[model samples]
Target: MTAGTANAQRFREFKMPDVGEGLTEAEILKWYVQPGDTVTDGQVVCEVETAKAAVELPIPYDGVVHELRFGEGVTVDVGTAIISVDTDPGAGPAGAPAAAAAPEQAAAAEEEDAEPQGRQAVLVGYGAAPSSTKRRARKPQPGVPAQPEPVKAQLQAELNGRPAAVPTPAPVAPAAVPTPAPAAPVPPAARPVGAGAAGRPLAKPPVRKLAKDLGIDLSTVAPTGPDGIITRADVHAAAAPAAAAPVAPAEVPVAVAPAAAEPGIVDTAARERRVPVKGVRKATAQAMVASAFTAPHVTEFITVDVTRTMKLVQELKQDPDMAGLRVNPLLLVAKAFLVALKRHPEVNAAWDEARQEIVYKDYVNLGIAAATPRGLIVPNIKDAGGKTLPQLAAELGDLVATAREGKTSPAAMTGGTVTITNVGVFGVDTGTPILNPGESAILAFGAVKLQPWVHKGKVKARQVTTLALSFDHRLIDGELGSKLLADIAAILERPKRLITWS
Candidate 1:
């Protein structure tokens, strides 16, 4: 038929999708499109934060945005319609058929507005239609006086003495409408621009939580995000001044200081703070606790002189092939681990309790443990067994960067066969790192220090470090564990087995 009729029939609704497997809900972090904006299929419409990670949702059909059902910061259940669109390409706001149907549409809109919105799972891109059953208005209870409709109606009846002759009294004057008196001025502390005076500050829940942990007031921190929202960087910047504030001199006076140093006495009320366990930290904690108790753990340690590995790192940094990549001892250690894994593939297997069997993976998804502001996350490099030295270094650098920025995807953190955690960066000599859940083993690399050791029967200073390998006793016996640890150490000590072994 006509374009107007076609436009009215082409409206569609897009429901939220399950971005990650088994995830029930996601909080809308930001909206990229508003009503009346043109959108295409596969265009990102909004960003949502799930329990595992933040993800962007793309629309599945081309359309002009008709309505946004929810606002940012709302935690919406999966499969709920968040937006509606008019899918007809040529549809405009001034379409004639829509205007002609205004009266019927208005009645329907009123009915819909009277009902409370409830979350119900619907197919993606399909929204539930408006309920056909209309609700009747509540009647006055017995013995209760009914409220007056309005003063204007009663006044107009009084002015017209005879009902038969009375015409609808002239419409009430606009100025005659009674309005409530102005509210009292709010206090300054309760009237901060971004928060108190208007409404809640424009910040995601995670950012707000971060500000709370850092003890930074969101109202005081200037927002730099789109639409004047507060972001993670803004909170960190607000906390910077407090962290950098200089401490008072010792000679100032013992009484003037904030508190005195004491031995074996901790003021838990003042010195301690508690943070809610949730998000990445909560998941990590639950997994660690379960893995530690379910699987019998056996840790083996070995001390080796890594002087040769350090020299190799320096040489690689200068080599033309690796000139632009990140060259460090971790690179060499990772390479050594990969070479060792090839020789002992048994170490790359997992104990499947449900199947009651050992599952050996042919490919290696090597996990690297990273400490981020959020918590500890292990994001793995997929198929790390097949990459060359430079390729491995590049992937390692990218993994570390993504983890530190809290941008690691859920897929990147799964399917790990083995893991490595470097405790060396924190200046620790050694640590017994727990195995990542679903993985067979984790290698902990400790601080490499220059120590006096006997070399060629002569005392000399050498770069030496201790490595701790923690594995599942259920699947890996002591012999297999010792062999894997010894292989890694040998590669690091000699720096030539990586070539020969590979």
Candidate 2:
């Protein structure tokens, strides 16, 4: 309805709150409201997953939700108004004061007397409702797939065209069932009549669209919809008709050399296939481009005989104390990085654009660059400089595990002063690593392998590894950069030197 047609209201915007201390940003894991959805104060409006955990954030004010800025999985900063509430926002609930009661109000009453009769407690705070709920992952059932788990349940409002009302719960029920997605795989508490046969939930418009594009059916296909919302893929599968030509099995094309072609590797496939730059991959490319072009990058390489370091890893693995721990060359390489940082603190710093200066950190928030199913996430351990060898080793293992499982939060990936890229894990000797945006330097740890080397006047096999440092030349001069690289090389040369120098 047009504002002038009947009634129009000016609504106040509810900005994303800092749910926890020092939490400046959060990813909008799911939106519970779209514009025009009614919501009550203290009701859950959306679920945001912070670095530490997923939390269900409540609505700060009551009203009809007027708009949402983006789709689910959007990362937003504190103070960014994510939803608009069109109503009397500052108004308090049913009979409470205009604002939440202040602690001083209660304290003032105590000071009056044992029986402070007739004297009213003066409340002097804004009428904002107290938030009792905390942040958490989006609500999901057991054995549910990750992709189809739309920002359903825990949302007080509905998005786009989905119905917002939920079935009222019965008092005598064994347990309350969550509201079902209309045409999703997981049926509602009780499947509705006239739904898909075999008791499957029906598909929604978008899901139907997806299925149509994929050549699927709506009624015949099994649903993979959130809250029983029919997914597009399911619809397409159902819509797709079986073909008579499919009666024959597909023959495996045996790879054979062309009769008249050259004997070398055939051009069966293109050397490279172009993929659309979208989603996380596209965003990564953009961030890299911005950093590479804007920041003056200088690449430096140092080949080190890390034979002793490799041997130490094996010894640590067999040691009783390190039995349960995950011990690998990465641990020793990480130790070498710390040693190098202590010798050269300036290398472990970033160029602060907002402050218009170089910010040198006393503690190392060591970021270990990890490639995960979600994308590349560099979750770092804060104050890594102070942690002991064993503590750091355990922390690294936990960080890698969390990242690989698609559970690494944004907090884990931010506030990194320096980054260590383990290109060696990919079996590559070395490549000029890209600096993690704000950070001035990034170190690349390459593979360790036996190579012929001249040591003690004899040509013998030694565990050789290459160290590559990529720095922002605009911040780190060539001489300082070279010295930093050399210090890392020197530490790897003599492991005992770290005991003294570090």
Candidate 3:
């Protein structure tokens, strides 16, 4: 290729794309590439923590790494140029010259003077809005002299590049304007500490917001993050003691004393810890709150002998068809729920408030709630109702594994028609689980324990577990909800019913 042609193969700026679900910004958690690193299309170049989850972003084109505009831990707005890559790797020294010749001051001035290009980034739909450079008017002091006419005009232009009103100074006698004495330097502890205090405690915006929400003072929280930064764990550690202690009434104040300094007596603060809710935890909290209040929830529980289902799980595991797939009581339970949904599709509907309609779905998007390092996320298997037992087992296994890895995509999380949360995995007996937003029902499976139960008029030890089904009362009445739960219980009680019911 010609020298001019090679040099013209410019560096492509990869702006931070909105991963999905209307996320506006993300914090760069880590970068997998640096300057001069060769990167291919579809290579995961960096990991970012969005408001929803930590997502690894892949490069869309092959190139040689040029620059990373923002560093790790910095929250970058969507459509902002994050990394630049030289598309033509062959133009080595020529490319280096352009980057090296670009002086920092010149770049800064150019950026300041440049108008919004209205360039579209990855993930098309809408371009980022033009950022305004609006500034607040500086308050005038009593004796401070006004800037000269030319300087004042220049300052006005720089503020917003528009003509602005400049306050002219009033004539005053030199003797009338007395010089004020120098103020005393304030001590750090004595200085007024507002939310935005100078030399403020280092914390991410999400962590700061979490501390604010939990009524935990960040200044008191110890910093454990790098560079003496206050992390989410640190904030949560500080809030733990307060959360565990008896909450004082709104009108009353209670005095809390640290435990005595005796060898065995540990201070409450020392023993306690606070965790700031963000990413998956924060999303789960908001979703649950919205699901609880918005939908009139009605939960029904049933305890049944799931010995037959458990046996079937074992049988499936040994079967040639299911040999490689994960075979567990959860797999059977999921299959049973899908079968029940098939029997009573009414319970598989969602309420469309805007349209004032009960939208019934013919297909099932079976959501399995998986607990990951981030928090609880329910990623679903699309068209699960049509999947066979082996198919369901495979999908369930994959869904859980993906969720555990925190790699479940936004698409996998959305459009869940119904959900199943297995609290049994945690050894919990049962729980009234809130329905996933937009879904009509959610089933909670509890721990299976050997319990004495009357089997054909004789008290026999059987594998028994409780099932809780919570549904939106506005869409599903108690009778329909009970029948659906009963159907699931009956299937588990007799695994053969799954064959007969279908």
> For each predicted model, how many residue pairs clash, with residues at least 3 apart or on different chains?
0, 37, 5
lDDT, candidate 3, 368-391, per-residue tens: 988888788888999999989888
The RMSD of every model to the true structure, in order and in angstroms, is 14.8, 21.4, 12.4
Write model 1 residue lDDT over 171-231, tens digit each, in one string.
4335555533335545444644344233445454456656665567887898765334566
Off by over 4 Å in 1: 1-11, 89-275
Candidate 2 stretches greater than 4 Å from native: 1-279
- The 10-residue segment of model 1 with minimum total lDDT is 121-130
Compared to the true structure, candidate 3 yields what TM-score?
0.69
TM-score of each: 0.64, 0.52, 0.69
lDDT of 1 at 6: 57
Candidate 2 lDDT, 1-502, residue by residue in tens: 3322212245567787776546677766666766768899898888875543456778867777765643454567789767767675454422222234454433222111122354322212211112254355466554333343234432322422336655444333233554344345333335453253334334433444444434445555654443233443344334333321222333445566556756666755433344443334554676689889888999999899998877788898888877678899788778878887888787777787787988788989888988864367677998998988889889999999887776665567668888899999889999998887788888999998899999999999999999999999878899989998888888888888779887
**How many Å off is the CA of 210 in candidate 3?**
25
